[model samples]
Target: MSTPPTSSGPQLRSFASTNRFLTEIASPSSLRPGYVLVGDEIFLYDRCRKAVLSTLVPEDFRDFSLHDLDLSETSIFEALDRAQTPSLMAPFQVLFIRNIKNLYGRGSKKEEFAAIEAYFRSPNPQALILFVADHIRIPTDVRRMDYQDKERFDRIRETLGEWCGTVELARVDENDAVRWIADTAESRSVRFDPDAARELADSLGADMMLISSEFEKLLLYVEGKNRVTLGDVETMVLAAKQRSLYELTDAISAKDRPRALALLHGLLNASDGGEDAAIGHLYMLARTFRQMLIILEKNVRDSRAIWQALWQGFRMPPFAAEDLIRQARRYKSRRELTRALRLVARADLELRSSPVNKVLVLERLVLDLCAEPKSSLYEPSMQFAIEM
Candidate 1:
């Protein structure tokens, strides 16, 4: 995430606002002297770095990948020393530090951090320091300038006062994701109707980098098209696991047992023999169903409310809200929903432990869940028994 270089010059601050980092960095007036970007999203960091450098050195400069830098061998002193170098051609040099979490080690890590603290005491004016601390906590000294807790977003405002500015990088919720898609589509001069963008966002989930790339692809594909439609998104966007899971739900809701079973089998086959990946998919599926069941029990009529509830718990694409509501309507009772979820959980366990035919096992589970009168929920079991 990046903010446009601030006109007031760069402000020393910490970014806590989730995925909107790009929007922040895009601001033409938010760049500062020393920037410590903390997050696990490498793509976000890379994009922010590019954006910032583009503004700082609009013409000529080499792109440096901090990941290539050996943090283990390079001491904090060495890093600062490198940052001290004058720009070969330009007035300023850009230093990109990737995987700042590596700066936190046990033995030598302590020394490195200490050196960093000392270096921060007197930052280089000629060099722009961009520290990418992907998911690692900044030291208290650095954080002291701008701290924000849920109850106190103004903590930074009050504490740092004029000394620094704090930008909170909150996780991109569904609404934000949708808005981002629309904005991105518009900026590319491509038409992204609400439904189409939502579809793409749902398919991409919270992976902004992938979402951005996919949006670009869609923009290119529909170059001359004035506005993108749902059909375009459906044809161009490949569904990620979350969307695929929702597809499975939709198939089950429609009593399309074959389709539901196919979806499950396809997911397993795509697992590449990784038990962890299969388990992770099932875990997400189970959690989604469980939440859907909860929403149904509440008898929530407002689709947006139901979606908001789910988004609070899971990173569902905003476009899937209606589908989830429709699927929720298919479950007449909490008992039936619970039963289906139990079957999913069992299938998850079987996938991990059972020596039996994995494909057959998953197929049976799907069929059972689609059984009518609950046949829609249990038919797979009967089919598996007969086939086996």
Candidate 2:
């Protein structure tokens, strides 16, 4: 996350609005002597970095002209001086300084700051510098920051604002996300249905990096087809979702406590595992319970009939639908589904509010859902809403 640069030049542009980025900062005319690309979103950051690189270094010149420097091991002056030196063989040189925030550490020298400001004021015409700062909060989400954290954030922003053309690659919100998906699919010559686009956004959260990869997979899955329907999305996308999520739900539905616990541990211990994955899992479980509640309300008994009925209403593939129908049969009454939904709701609230281990909270939730159904803890009025 990067704060907007101080008012002076039109060097800073955000990737959140694609049009603004393409029209303003992405243009060759907007290329600056030095750039500060800030954001935690690695994909967008990399994309913006590449865009700048394209303007600086041509593909053939990359071999001889592109310099990747890590500031952690080198001084700021040395890196800038090296970048300022002309390329031996290529027309222009591009220097990418990784983890640039290291240069602004507590023990940083005044000479180093002077060198940086000097380079910015009169940068080398033959070299373009990209200072990559990782893990800075954008717009400085103050609600999550303490006084010291806020101070550090402001200091970094101010320091970079003085030296480099800052561009923030902030997290993509829902509406922009939907448009991004649609536009990306269209660019790939794949027709993405509007409803399916929204569903993809809802299921995948707002991580554009992950969403982009998944969108590619979806297109490949529906090769030769002009239209990507909700059903295609349900089949192809859920297959990916199943790898991360379905096994845990299946274990719970099957009352296989050991397997469920193992899956839960895997989810919590995996590299990308954390509160976000836990929250996604919780919502999936809640959705499953809600589906079962619908089945119970309609009194659909036979697995075949239930699958057929669900096919009309839900966007799951045949195999997943069959599996869900079988799972729905495990519940003997509406109370069981209602109890599960209530448990899921309570878990959702706890996950968001409590500071306890998120994985542990989810583990407890799994235990409750798989355990025997208990009597109503709420009045009949409240039960109806959760259950049905």
Question: Top lDDT: which candidate number?
Answer: 2
- Identify the runs in model 2 with alpha carbons over 4 angstroms from their true place: 1-29, 139-150, 238-388
Q: Which lDDT values do the candidates have, in the order given?
A: 0.59, 0.66
For candidate 1, give the lDDT: 0.59
**Candidate no. 1 TM-score:** 0.53
Local error of candidate 2 at 304, Å? 42
Q: Highest TM-score: give the candidate number.
A: 2
Q: Tens digit of lDDT per residue, candidate 2, span 105-194? A: 778567877888888888887777877766565532336544654565677678766766666656656556666677767776778899
Number of clashes recorded per candidate: 43, 4
Question: Per-residue lDDT tens digits of candidate 1, residues 24-136?
Answer: 45554554555655444444455566666565555544543122344556655677787765555566666765545455434555565556556656656666666554443
Which run of 10 residues does model 1 get worst, by summed lDDT? Answer: 4-13
How far residue 160's Cα lies from its native spot in candidate 1, in Å, is: 14
Provide C-alpha RMSD values for all models, in order.
11.1, 15.8
